[model samples]
Target: MNKFGVSAQTLIAAAFGAAIMGSAFAVPKLLAPEAGAQPIAIQAPPGAPLSFADLIEKVEPAVVSVNVVSTQDLSELGDMDQFFEQFRGMPGLEDFFEQRREQQEQETPRTREARSLGSGFFISQDGLVVTNNHVVERATQIQIVMSDGREIDAELVGADPLTDLAVVRVKEPGPYPYVKFGSSKDIRKGDWVVALGNPFGLGGSASAGILSADGRELGAGSPYTDFLQIDAPINRGNSGGPTFDLKGNVIGVNSQILSPTGGSVGIGFAIPAELAKEVTDTLIQNGRVSRGWLGVQIGDLTPEFAEALGIEDVKGALIADVTTGSPAERAGLKRNDIILSVNGQKVTDSTSTTRLVAKLIANTKNKFDILRDGKPQSISVTVGERPADPNAISPVPGGANPAEPGAPSAVPGKMLPDFGVRLSPMDDATRIALGLRTGDTGLAITEVTKGGVFGEAGFEPGIIILDVNSRPVASVDAFERAIAEAKAANRSKVLLGLRVGQVTSYRTIDIPK
Candidate 1:
């Protein structure tokens, strides 16, 4: 009986083991699709794949890690901080903040070695790399590292601060992988994109995202400044990297982000490939970019102004001032004229108009459509080279006459009133009272009339007026000179450059002539 029981148990054990083995073999066969059959014909909905593995495989080799090393002298850091802080207000606290920040940066070392790591990509097989100008701006040494762990020294070929792009060159030439430029204009919102960069200095890092927005203006930070905003995970070291389309084309160059915590908030900005490509080409060809310029100071058309001019809406850039002898003035672009379009393309804002005009080849004759007194007018003007000095105010030659000695005291008629501030010449006492440095020069306000033009214009008694109608006014004489020129020209508004506290700023006001 015992022998019979043992035999039965052994047979049952053998049967159970065979069943388990058979189940394992059956499961794999069932899960694996048959070679002759398809994936059940499951339809992938119309959109990009949820995974970026294919993108990484296609674009990773084109991306490179950029390492920059710069030196910051202790005194220079203190001075730069002080200079910028003065413009941000709290002039008295400038030195205090600088000292504290310098100490902190020195002790804990925000960047003692002055090392910055960013990402860039090859534009040509001969080892030409394109990146953000800020990435390698002050770097004394630059190292480019490839994906296969090859490091090589790179030389800065050229950089354009206005467009925020830099070009660098590596010594070795090869059948190097690179990306072709794509038209950013064709990219709409919600387009799939893959960002390749060295995020946190981790080489060959990639993240996929979509174009969240386009034509984002960051507010006068750069001259040629239409940016494509993306929701990619671009971090500190991601600047200068390439944002690639699904076809592995370089669509944009990742530039900036709106982050307060110094980390990726998934809102990254890219210089559109359209803009970057032009700059890169110029840099590669001439070692610098030459941008065309139409010399005019423009203002956003306000509702009141638009209605006054019989414009249906604020749709065009209003000409506030035209530089004397400049292309605009030469082409008869008068003050108060609304710039409706540039080269026949409607301009809705200053940024778009500026960008359009910039893209014009230098010395090319372009047509500017304008609206004056409710009538459309066309003016032809030749675009000229942008002035090298942004700070040098264009002079209004013979625009004002010298006030006759012993003449009746002329008071401006229709003295629009508000805060009762008056314009006067800057003196030692006034400068000391206003806490102005010796280098400061402008028409200082000594007193205020109750609700007068000075008040209406948002002027304070201690404020110094530097420029009127885009013309520099270093003294009371120059201020009066500018006012006379505006009256003679029948202009109703003037833009003033001001030096308040310790920093230079600008404001626009309407002056009834």
Candidate 2:
């Protein structure tokens, strides 16, 4: 049973039945005025579209059907019911299914062929097409069917999985019909828009609806989300099809639909052309999209938190922690600093700040206005290239940690009863072997108790703790002092900067209750 108390199998059966018996679309007929002396034509509000035939005719030629053939391993397949779930044990089919299942079970490491259908559009005259990355991802063979009924083999030029956009090309000499991407900024809610795609394998289907909303994030992974929402009836086969404005310009790419019935429920999502253009342009030039990274952890400022920070307006991204040796730290950005603007544009939230920062070119200097200690401060920071995997932490090169200048006490190591770790001062010989500079301050973690918080937090031996809550700690006394200060200040967690071999990073740990 489905969550709505209907049989899930019943819905699937209904959909398959519709597919077999569905009829083609027909244009609506205009009703004649009933015996009136004066005749009036269809009227719409000013600047609204009353008709779509002209717009559809001008751009329909640019649309194409994307079909892919892929292979699936038999090991991935399960029992017989999986194959017959769609058939649902109908009359006179049980024995046939049983025989087929028995024959299939005799084979070892078998394979099967799968075919998928999707929609795409021509972005350039020389057979350059744009579609969703998922349509052609892992596809062994792809065929593009033009509106003229010509099927052409296409090659993948580039694909960006982060934005779900891809580019393909066919090396043909003749020019092809194409569509131009228009600015999504100009489109607004209640504006008339049209979606053209191969819905349900029906070629060149068109649906009309208004822009229901914009900047909708439907949790389609990746932080580059800024989906345009529309009431157009897009379906499974409509992925990567273009949604056009009244002037026949492509403003969005229909990507997803929100429906429990496996059909359009008047809620469909499209990748905004503005964001799509950026990703496709990068894919065209670099074959992949590269974004700038700030290496800072930021959070949205709640009203209560803002009031405590003495800010009248509860806006902007609050910096919770900055990575050690990162561009933000090198630029003097500190924890508790509020990011107000980037490149003179106001940042409404943490996500906006990330989007703005990512648009910046790596190694380019950008201006940022921040609120530090209740005062406005301006600073210039050079952006850095984002790592391939932002969540991974690499071990620092051995002997690269910096050591303190002072001499160690008689004993080098001491046990922390509360934190459940053995901390030790960095001796010169050990520091030299570890490649530490003379100015680095921190005690080395000799051991972390097996069941301790640090162990569960992924901390291992050989890493040096350089600072606690932004305060340098070269000895046990200093470490204890910093922890005391953090607790006294009523902070729930303390940020720690650690030197793992040559790499430097920051970690936040909760204060023990």
Candidate 3:
């Protein structure tokens, strides 16, 4: 078993399940259906619908198969001499290898048309369709196959890679059947959800399952979206299809699946309708989305951190570092401030805080409630437009060059036995190398004993200890004084503000009692 207590699996984008073509075979006469044969009937479980045929029929027409054809450059395929080398001495295989090489040499085409399949559904009568961005993002040509086998050429309208959603319009206009978005927030765990898609290129396939979970963050790839988890057996070629409630309203869009094999193992995720609808509308109106930027690196307030801060509840985001000249910096936001809320909405964690700030309109004043030095305060900041490249706003800090003439080198300092680390006073050279402000003061970690408390807690050499229990520590003496004060206060742990490389963060260390 893996760390998650389940078998290791891969998260696959459900977009391209290749359809296998097979030779036809004759059927036995004995296997043929008898005249006036009746369909098999199965007893329904309690509280279950007798059949989903009616619901499937109602929504099947709007669902479509997205066919994408893009050019693939094959010039990168290197020589095949090594591949043919293995068969040189094999019995009766020399001729086969030579023939293959000759055929490969004769083929001079450098590019080929690659076809991929996915699913989508019309969202308007004028042929506006919703699908995953990956489905048609690279398509040189797109075709939508309807339920009745009618093929209509389509063009990409707009796509949002952050949310993995896209809008496409059919070139041939018509009064098409479409589906409407429903409130995904109202859907509860265990509520029945029917997924309609073209799984494995099988057009108009439907699978029934419950909403396994909601508000799930897959990873860093989809920071803006909190995916709705389902067990609807959606598979490849199902990307961008709609998951419908019993009312035939689209509540989610099928996007990905977690499976040991490429096929679905029942764990699937979809984009919630609320976020999807919002992004779709914006894409339809604008070619791209522009999010608000707060310009602060934040971390979750853990229970240990709360104890250090003398707080009863650990329910806020800890501001680690504020960008220079950012909206946050201009609003007087500082390091170590705990964000309690944004615009009156209570901040739950770092992720929620990021999402909240991103939803704010650019150039608009927003209220932020924060806790500084155990006191509550509110500040108003005019949000700015997020940079096109997220990293452009907060690039990774460069490493220090101790070899430079004026760079500070590690010096022997007082050792904190309990923490198994030595501290040295920060100097002008160290501050400049760290790219810190002139007034910034801290005790740099000179050495960390392996397998000791500090090392186990992730403390390492070159890290600077900025504060102890919110008190600035400018030297080894100050760090010792703060530790003594914490011990005198009978605190079990003390929070330390640390500057690791260029990023600021907080870590709680146990106070030896």
TM-score, per-candidate, Cα-based: 0.65, 0.62, 0.79
Residue 375 of candidate 3: its Cα lDDT?
92
How well does candidate 3 match the true structure in TM-score terms? 0.79
Candidate 2 residue-wise lDDT, 76-193, digit = tens: 3376668766666677687787667777777788778889989999998888889999888877788888888889998888897878899888756549999999988898899899
Off by over 4 Å in 3: 1-47, 70-114, 394-408, 426-435
Q: List the residue pairs that clash in candidate 3.
A: none
Which candidate do you rate higher for lDDT, 2 or 3?
A: 3
> What's the lDDT for residue 24 in model 2?
50
192-252, model 1: which lDDT tens digit per residue?
Answer: 8889898888878888889999988887777686789999899988999999887778889
Report lDDT (Cα) of residue 65, candidate 1: 96
Which residue runs of candidate 2 sit more than 4 Å off their true CA positions? 1-51, 70-114, 219-222, 323-325, 329-334, 394-513
What lDDT score belongs to each candidate, Candidate 1 first? 0.74, 0.79, 0.85
The candidate that wins on TM-score is: 3
Cα shift from native, residue 328, model 3 (Å): 1.1
> How many backbone clashes are present in model 2?
6
For lDDT, candidate 1 versus 2, the one ahead is 2
Q: Judge candidate 2 against the unseen true structure and give its global Cα lDDT, from 0 to 1.
A: 0.79
Error of 3 at 239 (Å): 1.0
* Best lDDT among the predictions, by candidate number: 3
- Tens digit of per-residue lDDT, candidate 3, span 48-85: 67678999999999999999998887752255777778
